[model samples]
Target chain A: MCCESDQPSLTQAGHRRGQIQLLAALSAIVLVWCGLLPALGRTTVLRQRIAFLEARGVNPSAKFFTEQEAGWRNAAEVERQLQEHPQAFWALPWRHR
Target chain B: MSQQSRQVSDDSLAMIAAGLMLAVSLCCTALGSTGGGGAAEAAASAWQNPLSALLKLPKSWESNPFAEVSGWLPGVVGSQLLLGAALVVGMLICRVRTGEFLLPFLKVFLLSVLAYVLAEQKVVKYYGLEYALWALLIGLLISNTVGLSGRLRPAVRTELYMKTGLVLLGAEVLFGKLLALGLPGICVSWVVTPVVLIVTFWFGQRVLKIESAALNMVISADMSVCGVSAAIATAAACRAKKEELTAAVGISLAFTVLMMVVMPPLIQLMGLGPVVGGAWVGGTIDSTGAVGAAGAMLGAEAEKVAVTIKMIQNMLIGVVAFGVAVYWVTYVERTEGTRPDISEIWRRFPRFILGFLGASVLISLLYENLSDGAGFVKAVVDGGTKTMRSWCFCLAFVSIGLETDLRTLSRFLRGGKPLVLYVCGQALNLLLSLLMSLLMFEVVFPEAADVLRK
Candidate 1:
């Protein structure tokens, strides 16, 4: 019963097919990633800006982003605001409001 | 292939993975970014972008491709595949009969995607019909209608998926945030949550005399803590049946919907300040998403206070899960005339909890020390973990549905004791949470409340 020859053909076939399916699924995912890596390069740049702003103690809310983009608030001012109201900087919603 | 050896190996793998994550997280903290004292990010209630598909409805499709999709569609899908492969690899490492996991895993994944897509619908998102409930319902529909086939049985790993997710979830339970609002937040969340859970469990056992103590405990934890997540964790800790867990989740989600709708308006009518109002909803509501919604309806201040309070309450699940595991092993499942020793308890105690706590402590400390604060945590740590965790939970819920015979669940509902148990527990929760919130915010720590107001 412990031997490979003892195992039924149907069971062996099923196992083989399942392994192949798993690999195939994984391959498809890899292929998709390969296709989109270039597109993702631009997105990564935006993410880096977000990270830089966050590193400067700026709140990363949409409002903060808009303000920064419009030159209404700079990193220094945002940092000051964070110092005064730490909780306010992190008061974004966990989910959709 | 003895059960004991299998258990040891499985637990060993979990512990190793957990330890590795903690160590890596600590290293990341040492190499932390230079972002000042801005707060670190914790796991949010729902995914910021839940849906990720190439084909979008015409109305959703915008002019720019980047704007239309979330910039990197492949990254999202590839990341998910990586998570799936990781889990499968973990199972295989533990000698979980490799080829058998694929079809069932695929089924669960497909169901979860469907649940996510359904949750993405405008109306569903508004009502907060989360993927947890949808996954369970859809799985239930398939099982009850066509019935789960033999091929699916090999992949139905509800406990495994849940345990993995819980361990990942542990990273998000930042202890530093517990002191964010100071002593008042601690008293309201930590104090009220345990009291309500204890009282509810006692009520179920002594007063209600429910047949399954595990079911009672699961429901109590679910109703008093953070809904589905709590239910899954507690169920695993106490070794509750799949059907019983399902029933508890069903009851929780039903009341969660009602409470989310009713609580905000009631708080408004009572003329509670945003801090008091948010704390009330945060402490009482079972679901984190619903708590956010209820708070949002009140105001921005309320939303902030409520979500923060709920985050505090969320931390209690680890303690509650550990306590339940200890209690069940020592008191509930002890053999007559023989007290289990420390080693016995250690053996019986759920190993995943060690993983869970380890992850929490690691990530919490990492968050505290790290610079770019929430941004780095959100983008790097939580971003990867959240995707994996969501998949694990979705798969777990689906597996639960597949394994559960609706008939068994219906049997539990026959006397409506579970419903009564949930309702009564919720009632106590509401009253106690409200009183605790009022006393802490209004009387004991008015300054903290003022800070919240600011």
Candidate 2:
């Protein structure tokens, strides 16, 4: 039953076509890497935005918590600040004014 | 192909994967100590932002693509080889013919690698399209168009890969970090997130009348919680189809890119300040990276607030997964008028979550109590297990794509109800999250905000 011959004609056709499609997909990846990706990176908008963010010491593309070093640094700093100012939790909102 | 035979096969597969999970976790933990005291202290301090962690990030490819690829390619290949070996052993234990499976597994791994490399492209990463999506797309294109051979069917083991990856991910979800934000962070994440999740889920179930409850739940969790990770966790808990997870990830990530780009500007225009703006972005944005990106744009204070809140929220996956599992056992999967036994729930519960939770506990303890543990564990994770996890998930998505039929998957989304549910849920999340962030960071705990601005 596990043999390919046991598969119906339609199923067999799908397997054959899938092989070809897989090749096409691989080709597309190559095209994108070689062409589309570099082109997009060079675009004015993305380049400018990334430059601006980098200048500000922000990583605009950081997707996960671990990816952002500034984040953990800031977390430690926040903890320290809170420790020094325990009353901040109850500090009057108007005090900021 | 009898039910009994399938059950036995599943048990064998799980037992083997369990061994693999333990091996990976232990190795990741042990690898932390390899850096010696000086390196560990340096990394530990760096985690406190006092320097080199960024140098080791996966983005190192930008500076020296070949060198970076050569550096990581070996580790990824080695880990995947371990996974492959384990599966082969499992197959042998099950008395399945080894020859039939090997070639298919190789094909899938190679294809998944291709997809992973493609997703790593700077433009794709910038657009926030993760490797999972690319893997699924490539597989889907092949399966739906050319169609796959029946011979390749033996290797599409999505569940195994997901379970293993989840265990690895568990190591990353250190519970100790949850305290970093204190009460203000808690109010914003714990209070607003679940409210938004439950309400959104209820809206999907009751109002939208979504046909597939699993789809509704996954989309709800993905939008409300931390995007792909939440969706993956919930989907596994509820045993949602891979196609549903794929769709949920697609919808959430697409919107994540838009929101990540748009929110910082919008916040500046509104003059919400970094605390509120960071909180808003953290709570509302689906992806952690996007949240950080958005927060960084607001300024360092906002980035910290945004990320810390999001990281705290990330911890909720443990509770959420357990809750969903319990709910599913007690209510969703119960037969009409029959009380569920403890044994039934135990059997039905997703065991991978236990692995996830266990890994989290193990790492959290190590991070908190062990001397220089933070640096060591971070080393192991950043160096070893993290890359392995990326490989695991990429393979899982590829397998999912291979196994799913596009026509059937489209049927799940026919009514556009999922899209409506996501948009509406996100709308609620944005509104509620904004209010809570204001109340917590402004009115109730404005002092916390003041400290953050420093």
Candidate 3:
């Protein structure tokens, strides 16, 4: 089964064509089944969730200060105070506080 | 019209099959493009804050493109002429490559099954079937159908396709974030993998006495380290025969599917915490995508833990590949009288892995130097890499399905030893990981555990 045949017939071509059609149909069904349909469902669900959050006035994307962020802020403040009052910074009541 | 005439007919049939396989591959690519592109556009709309958008779209979409595709198909199918046109073009490509249609055709079917299972189970909130399934299937198809009992010339196209896919896969390996698991994650993976490999190899050889060292190693690496991707990397490095590669992939995929379906509920039943559960699942499960799905089923925390753990494991590919290459050359090649030179090592080394590492390193450097600019670029790059990787994997699956014969696969199952080996190894992985996570994190090292909690 390794050689080419002479003068391909209409029937052979038709057979090949039919196979391609079947495959294409199957692929389309799968594409929709696996990809499109579920995506639609998710979009609906997400939209609902977004709407609900908006209604509740809760920003889904709100940024809350993390401990790391707080630490950075604290560090910057300490540095600023140190730059302002080099030696006697530790003596101040506010600095001690 | 005697023997020559019959030979001619056989050739024609083979040609027809080849043509069909090619057609199906083209169609799959087209369908994937349409489905993928439509999803991308919708995801772009969802990408309001590019950095946040990247996190939302690519992570979610990569985890499950079907969900994304479904969301956009309803509204955009009409307005997005490009999607429809792309779909049509994909169909036409399938038509032209009609002879080799069965492989990709089977893949679309398998992908559908996986997608349905994922959605029905809600394994991951938005993820569909694992992309690794597609890759495994394509690898099997190519090795079996196109590469089987054929002249080198006939198989050239398929091999070219396989190599190209591997190269593209390299682009997906982002080096920087791979280190996020820190030294602990890396240490765990490195320690566990070699132990598993050593045990499995010993069992395969001394205990089971399997004739093929190559087969033993391939299966061991696949089962112990990762799945088909690991098998392929190791197989290439070891210069294993095509049959060995095929057998290892087939075995790995079968177990992976079973594990993906079984592990989630098992974890829930065991009442394992997210960190423990994620570590257990990540260490035991063969496929990364499936691990994510299984983790997602547990909870967001579990998903994060599982994915992070698996990412660390995935990063081990480079180390494992290099080690295997060195071992194979020094040990196996020396005894086998096929010692390869340095150039051969370069040739045999799956080059795309370099791309994966390169992309990862570049991303890391960018993130370090330009933290603000890094996120946006990383997002786009991640999206592109994921798309390409998935496509390459899908194509490989199609190739595998076309090449495989069910009878041959069944013949290998006469003895239940391989199955037993896999189960035992996986159980060991679960127990080991669970113990480590519990003792090291929860009790002994609460400080480290706190890092995960955050």
Best candidate according to lDDT = 2
Ranking by TM-score: 2, 1, 3
What lDDT would each prediction earn against the true structure?
0.64, 0.73, 0.48
Query: Given candidate 2, what's the lDDT at residue B117?
Result: 67
CA deviation > 4 Å runs, candidate 3: A1-97, B1-158, B240-246, B268-271, B335-360, B373-377, B411-414
Per residue, candidate 3 scores C-alpha lDDT tens digits across A1-97 of 1112121123545655645654665577467656665566567665564344233222211111010122122223333433454432223233444
* Per-residue lDDT of B245 in model 2: 90
Off by over 4 Å in 1: A1-97, B1-76
In DockQ, how does model 1 score against the reference complex?
A: 0.03
Residue B446 in model 3: lDDT: 45
Q: Which candidate is the best by TM-score?
A: 2
1 versus 2: better DockQ goes to:
2
Return the TM-score for each candidate structure.
0.75, 0.87, 0.58
Residue B358 of model 2, lDDT score: 78
Kindly give the stretch of ten consecutive residues in candidate 3 chain B with the minimal lDDT sum: B50-59
**Winner by DockQ between candidate 3 and candidate 2:** 2
Q: Write the per-residue lDDT of candidate 2 for residues B192-293, one digit (tens) a residue.
A: 899989999999889988987888899999999899888888887788877789889889988999998899999999989988899899999998877877
Candidate 3 lands at a TM-score of 0.58
Q: Rank candidates, DockQ, best first.
A: 2, 3, 1
